[model samples]
Target chain A: MTSVFLLQWQRFRRAPLMVLSFLALTIVFVMVMAGSNPGNSMTVPTYAHPALAEQQQDEWLEQLNKSEGLQFELVEEQEARQAVLDGDTGMALQLMEDDYRLLIVADDPNRFEVESYINRTYAEELRIRQLEQQSTSGEARERVAEMLEEPALTVETQSLEGEQESFVYDGQLQMLFGMALFFSIYTIMFSLMKIVEEKKFGTWNRLILSPLDKWQVYMGHLLYSFTIGYVQIVLVLVLFKYLFNFDVGDQFGLLLLITAVYTFSIVALSMLVMGLVQSPQQLQAVVPIVATGMAMIGGAFWPIELVTNNMLLAISKVLPITYGLDALKSVAIHGRGLTELMEPIAVMLLIGVVCMGIGINLMERKR
Target chain B: MLETEELTKVFKSKAAVDGVSLYLDKGESVGLLGPNGAGKSTTISMISTLSKPTTGDVRLDGRSVVKDPGKMRKVLGVVPQEIALYEDLSAYENLQFFGRIYGLSGSRLEQAIQQALELVGLKERQKEIVKTYSGGMQRRINIAAAMMHEPELIIMDEPTVGIDPQSRSHILEMVRQLNKEKGLTVLYTSHYMEEVERLCDRVYIMDHGTIIASGTKDELKSILSGEETIWIELDRPYPELFAELAAHPEIVQAAETEKGIKLIIPKGKRILGSIFQSAERHQAQILNVNVQTPTLEDVFLHLTGRKLRD
Candidate 1:
């Protein structure tokens, strides 16, 4: 086993693409997220109607501040319209005499909430004015004001892990975590592909002919994948925390723990693919489809909260990376501890075991 | 000592190797000779523990290696038909890795690597990656990788199939030296009869998986002891006369060739008159007529009624 491990380590060290692509891909994701969001925070920017009266403008701004998690900005009416046209602002609004008009960009994840918030805010203000006018008597008007002060039915969201952060959408940090978890599977893919390579090149048969047991060869490869994944995660996280001043919460050890288990599952999945494919070239076609599809469905491309489709959310739950990335988020952003992370970690291990069993059976059948 | 008892391997309802039994004494060099797709590689793979036989057993000094081949593996070195060395690693690195897997370590592993590289004549370029080497060089390193562990038996399966003539000779010489000077037991398999004729003390000729004949050179040649083999190369085809000549009772076996015909006849110079008369009656121009003693090739032809290569 040690011999196989050392050999794989040497061989992997020679594969510069593995390390280079990991860093390059993570960097690209981080930059795209940071560049897209203002101040590199996850909050999408919002602006009130610039045509409103100055006094009403302040009121509208105040309401936006309390309505959602967006960062609200104020600008002239023409400037805001142009911003929307040029795809600068996430959403734009115009207040007409009787109703309001909103211009939304295509396929915005937050379109529904922004539209709902603006419409609700405007309708509520109009409804209050109507109530004040209709109730002319001092007692009735005072009652209307009191009722508008706070709604009788309101929800209070509580964080089970820890303190609720001011902005839940730190895009830069989420992108880092997503990409870290997403691309970590590539190592396992490459590692498992070695099985095909050995068979093609006749080395696998030679290894079998050697004195070493077959289990030793597998252990060496699995350990290599796990170790390389750990190193990649640590490298990215360290760079973000120190060099880029990216906050990764306080529970870093838990982060590593989740990543380790997640990587184990990824390696096991790659083995399953290896057992299915007959050649390294076959893996070339298979790995991208499986990895990309899983990552896309697993919400690695975007936050699950941002995914509005219930069916998609269900699929994400079934993907191993979904739990992995979630546990990572719980550690790096939510400051969650081991117990809070138990669900995802356990699910990942379960996936690991199932994939490993199936992979071993398939590989054995091929032998 | 190594022995196989009726080893058989089947794939998709057809046997690739069928009921082959062979024995090799310690310090003996044995050759397994067969054409392509004749189950030579399959037989070697089964013996090397790379393939599990469908039935029967392969034994190393009396211990069956069918179920658990650990002990047998320790004492065997296998050089596959393919260039199995790691292309991304240096020759020395490939040797070191194989050595470690064979349980060598520390200074001993280093010594093994050095000795293997020197034996393969790749000591100077040991630091270069194997992919950078020529095909023959890669094949040499492949052989070197097998020898790093110094097993009791070295099984080479068609090691010189595709290489420069110089490298082929170099490998043949190496195999001969390893067998003669070091007294290493060898199980050499090849379609090239001359290689086996020069290097192996005993030979097993296999066709379609099973061993058809096994004996010393003289003993195998004795299969055609009472017959003289004749080769006649003609300028043109003589199908009709060739077919008629094949029906001759005195001719033990007759095969028509692209050029003319080959005949195995009972030993007697007087039969030459009848052969010449038949050729003349067919109006065939015999450019050359050669009579020779039976070789391993002739023995294979006599037993299987087919050429060793075809």
Candidate 2:
């Protein structure tokens, strides 16, 4: 076992380009996620003499001492603008006049209530001032206040259909999972093809005819491929977490479990390819075509949602990558608990076992 | 002792190795001499457990290899016709890998590798990758790799093919040394008759997937004793000389060329003097005269009606 591990390590060491690709992919992921969102951008300062402007506005409002009519508060321009837009505040008062007269800047285009309030208050104030010149009458003041108090219309905001945010994040997580699955499968298949090439070149025969049993040679190759696939998955996941801001949510344990399952399935599929194909070139040309196509249709490169029909979806559901992606998406993006993802996880595990059984059977048959 | 009993291998409809039986005593060097496609390599492959014989059984010390190849594999070393060393790996590394596969490890493995390399006279250059070595050097290392496990029986399938004469001789010498000094039984296969004649204690000449002749050099030579081979060189020989040589009572076979006439006489010593006297009468000056014993090649030609190379 130690020798097998050492041999595998040697194979990995020899394939530095693959490792470098994984690292580069992580960087690309980080770059894409970091640069895509604009909401995270810093705010630009647009205020000039903000404190002085607020003080002047407040002092001017104080001078218009008929405070019973209406009043405005000095606030940050952005905050004030937002409140007006949201219909939280009636209107903003930047300046006011004092001759039983008043001025208001109507931020809302349909400021009907605020306008009425201003009009009635001004009228009442004029009447009070005139009455003060002669005789102050409480009945006249009450009449003016009564005229100002117009009935207000109540409005309720609601939508007929409930809003459900589309599972876009789930889709993205599926894509990442799909990519990881595809890469892992591709790596294992490629490694197997490399071994076939070695065989064709007589390198394998040299090793086999040497005092080694079939198992040692097989295990050495298996370890090399397994390590490659495992590393590819790790790199893709790390990239998802950091670069894509991919919330592989919180299920680290579930993610690891899914990853292990996917790795085994891919490795077993590779062994099947190796067992069936005699020539290295044949293995190389055929494996990626079949594996990549399966992954694509199974929703690795694109979301399964794009295939709207029930039949295609049903077919995708049966694919190993589909189950793998589903489990990953459930764990990573939806933050689904383990129980929620058990079905897909179980399917993935089953696929791994079935593939392994078939792969070993095929190998034994060849022998 | 290694024995193959009625061993046969069929590839599709054609028999690659027909019912063939042969044996090599322990510590004895036996050679399989045949032309290309003579099933020499196939026979070696089956005997070494690298390939399965379609029918028949191979036994090492009376233990059936067919029933339990693993047991046979344990005691067998194979040096294939093609150089089987890993081109990318150093000679020592290749040896180490094979040694480990044969269940040699630790200091024992190291000692075995060293001994094998020394036996092949390649210990000094063992650190170099096999690809970096000359063709002959690679061949030597190829054989050395097989020897690493120090198996009781060594099977070499045309180990000297395509090698230079010096390297070929060196490999042959190494094989002889291994057999003589270490008492390692060897089943050597080659097309070169001289190689077998030099190194093999016994020779089996095969053709068309069947062994046609098998014996010691002298024994095989004795097979052609009824016919004496006579070689005569002349400045110029007439076509009629062929007829004249064929007419001799003792001459069993005759072939004439522009420069000479070769006659196979049943009793050469009695008839050679008469043939020379007859040649003198025909005004044929004998530039050279020689009477020789039959070699393995002659035995092969006599039995198969074709030269070994043909």
Candidate 3:
């Protein structure tokens, strides 16, 4: 087993392009998609309607700018319209006294976030004005503001994983985790494809006819795939955490544990794929399809919270990457502990075992 | 030291090798001769413990290796038909890995690598990557990898299939030295009649998943010794005369050659006079005629009625 494992490392040293290219792609994709200030805020150009006075428009701008997740910038109506038309910004907001209009020229994923922010701000400001109109003391607005500082009643939002704050999406960590795990699929599956190549080229028969046990050979190959995948993901995560200043939470050890389980699950999943394939060319076509499909359907490209289709959510339940992304986000965003993470971890291990058993059985049956 | 008794392997109810029984003594080099799809590879795969026999026994030194292949694997080395070495790795590294798998380590492993490389005549180029080498060089390294542990029995399956003559000769000579000098028992399989004739002390002619004949080379060739093959060359097509000769009483077997016709007749026959008369009646011009003693090729042709390559 050691001999076979060591030989794989030597081969990897001779041609490290496939693995390295995946790692580099992960870095490039995250940097490009997430942009400079991920999760901090999204900037949306805003302009007041001409019927509104300058003073009222300034008040609306101040109220809209109070949101922590969406930054509203005041601009001339013509400039905001031109910004959307020229494709500079994906959307622009035109504010009215009682309502607002969104001039969207292109589809933007962050459009939901900006709209949610403006809706809540407008409702609160309008209600305060209404309260002030009905009050005889004429200090209803001030009292409402003071009362909001210390609310009489609050509803605590928690998840199944014990006590937790409301969900706060960290785009930097999301991109970092999502891309790292997604690209690691390619690294792991392509590395495991060596087993198929060896069988095709007949080197597998050489090892089988040798004195080594059959299980030893399999263990060697599987261990190599696991290690390479684990390293790529960890390295990518570390680089993003330290070099790019992405906040991946302070539970570093828990993060490593999650990566290990995810890597194992992926390795076993790759094994199942290998067993289904007949040749290396078939596997080459399969790896990308499996990787990209799993990423898209399993919520690696976007958060599962945003995916609402019942059938897709049902399919995501069976995929290891779904649990992997969930566990990772729970760790980074929700700050959940190990006990809370048991569900995802156990699900991942179950997938690993089931897939590995079926995979090896199918492969041996073919032989 | 090794034998298989009625060994059979069936895939999806089709027998790849059926009722094959052959044996090899220690230090003897035997050949398995057959065309493609003759189950030569399947037979060797079963014998080498790479595949399980569906309903037979492969015994190594009186112990059924089918039950326990560990001992057999420890003493057997297989050189597969394909170039099986890791192309991305250097030849030296490939040998080192194979050696280690067979329990060689430290100085012993290093010595085994050196000896295997030396045996294949690639010691000087051992450090080069296998993918960078020519096809012949890669083939040599393939043989070297199987030789890493110096097993007592080496099963080589068409080791010289697609190599240059120089490399083929080098491989044949190396096999001879290994068998004669090192006393390494060999079960070499090939479709090329000359390779088997040159390297094997005994030969087994197989076709359609069964061994038709097995014996020493002389013993196999003697199957056709009762008659001699006559090659009669004509200037052009003489279908009528060739048909007449084929219908002749004493012509045991007649086949049309590229030039004219080939006939197998009694060794002491003097039917050249009748052949000439028939040719003259047809006005067919004779180019040349030659009579030759029976070779393994003739013996195979006489038995199977097909060319060795066909």
Proportion of true inter-chain contacts also present in candidate 3? 0.95
Relative to the true structure, candidate 1 has a C-alpha RMSD (angstroms) of: 5.7
lDDT of every predicted structure (CA atoms): 0.82, 0.72, 0.90
lDDT of 1 by residue, B29-88 (tens): 999998888899999889988889999899998989887788878888889899997899
| Candidate number with greatest lDDT | 3
Clashing pairs in 2: A29-A243, A30-A243, A211-B101, A248-A332, A249-A332
**What lDDT is reached at residue B182 by model 1?**
90
**All candidates' TM-scores?**
0.83, 0.70, 0.87
Clashing pairs in 3: none
True contacts kept of 1: 0.90
Number of colliding residue pairs in each model: 1, 5, 0
Misplaced by over 4 Å in model 3 are: A45-66, A72-85, A90-150, A155-171, B232-248, B255-262, B272-288
lDDT of 3 by residue, B1-310 (tens): 9999998889889999989999999999999998899999999999988888998999999999999999999888889999998888889988888888888899999999999888898989989989999888888888888888778999999999989999999999999999999999999999999999999999999988898999999999888889999888999888999889989998887777678888888899999999889999999999998898877877877888766776
The better candidate by DockQ, 1 or 2, is 1
Tens digit of lDDT per residue, candidate 2, span B1-310?
Answer: 8899999999888999999999999999999999898999888878877678999999888999888777777777888878765576688877887777666889999999999888889989988877899999999998988787778888888888887999988999999988999899988898898989999999999999999988888899998877767778888866666577778776766666446876666653587678777876777778988787777876776677566776
Worst 10 residues of 3 chain A by lDDT: A163-172
Worst 10 residues of 3 chain B by lDDT: B301-310
lDDT score for residue A148 of model 2: 58
